[model samples]
Target: MTDIFGVVADATRRELLQVLLERYLAPESATGDISVGELVEKLGLSQPTVSKHLKVLRDSGLVAVREVGQHRYYRLEPGPLDVVEEWLVPFLSVDSLGGGLEQGEASGAFAAWSGVQMPASLRRAGESLQHPSDAGAAVGRAMADATHGTRHRFEEASEAVERKVFDPIRKKLKKD
Candidate 1:
């Protein structure tokens, strides 16, 4: 396998990835795949230059190609990004920003959010509102509780969808 980091280091390749990501997120995108001509036109680059970068991305498994007649379509493949996200999680911790929270607490939050961590400073601020001396603390705590509950529910729903929908589709694709 190509070095994933090295393949993504080029500015053009990153731009290509960004374009694919945008198409993937667009509601009108049926398959989230774009043709080489469309990419060349969108990025205002020569077709050969785009093709070269696309070859690098394809070799690194950052993108997948689908052939339709004589034309080729490309789509972003996000599986490899888990490696980058895992390596960056520690650097993104609240403790790394400043003297805020313990590394373990920060990492725990990152794990809970699957790569995104709630800043330790924010978490501590919420906890500090537990003081009985201020009536405002009661309202703050209530709001915090509601937010936490909502986040937990969202996480649960996401997990359910991944298991019931995406996981099965991935399994079938692999078997083929």
Candidate 2:
């Protein structure tokens, strides 16, 4: 079935989603639309590639587009994906793991899972996981310097995340 899951499964589409999400969350946007040129620049993808992904997003109803003179501006709708989220949220996090298991006894999740009647089994597992020495070793060796990406690539990535990821998430949190 061609659902939200299918639409987002492509890496290119996910990158486009990230771009749109950032633009939508920008403080300056009264309307959530972002232009194709902006997406092309941000994703470092060719214009044709961007347009193709945008078509998929539009077909899935995950994005809506508006025409402005010669330009087509696209924005995320986000509502249709709720069904996928509902189905997937159970795997995201189990509710306090089952029930009455207190904060510490379970150590991690699955502690509250009601099916595990004997907390003793859970306790034993937690005990084994306990590390005696969390001592930070002083290294005489210099750090192995490595680059995550080229300087331009890193800058572009950082800017996208700052604009498209963090800003939107912050705005949503502030609402709550």
Candidate 3:
């Protein structure tokens, strides 16, 4: 789906998107909302100019607005971001390269061509960090885990429901 973000990739629209994202990330007031005046001050753009950018942003689904009394507050909408992420998957996948990357070659001829660069120590650290089960691996473990359906370190969920509910309380009580 061609989204507002596709339209928003333009320089002016992107600047507006960045401003909106920043506001959502760090809200200024009780409602954490921003008005056209606030955006004008923050971006140093005129009211109508900011409004024009905002209109494009709003039309593209990159932003959402709410009316409170006489004010209109704008914030980012993350739903379209998911679609963009999915669309980017093929570009992110290494399997598409086929036949796997050859060793030594991974750093020399191939690396030179692909613009890959890394310090020796950093490369060693990365090598040491490889999953034991996947000997000779160099890609990120999170991507490996995802491809293999292995549970990610941060994504662990307790099989025991009661324990899941009580563990946090237990920690708090113990602390008390």
- For each candidate in turn, the TM-score is 0.57, 0.56, 0.50
| Winning candidate number (lDDT) | 1
Extract clashing residue pairs from model 2.
Answer: 22-164, 98-112, 98-113
lDDT of every predicted structure (CA atoms) = 0.75, 0.67, 0.60
Rank by lDDT, descending?
A: 1, 2, 3
Comparison by TM-score, 2 against 3, better one: 2
Instruction: Write down the lDDT that model 2 would get.
Output: 0.67
Looking at model 2, report the run of 10 residues with the lowest lDDT sum. 137-146
Off by over 4 Å in 2: 99-176
- List clashing residue pairs in candidate 1: none
Candidate 1 lDDT over residue span 80-111, tens digit each: 98787656644444343335565555543464
- Model 1 scores a C-alpha lDDT of 0.75
TM-score of 1: 0.57
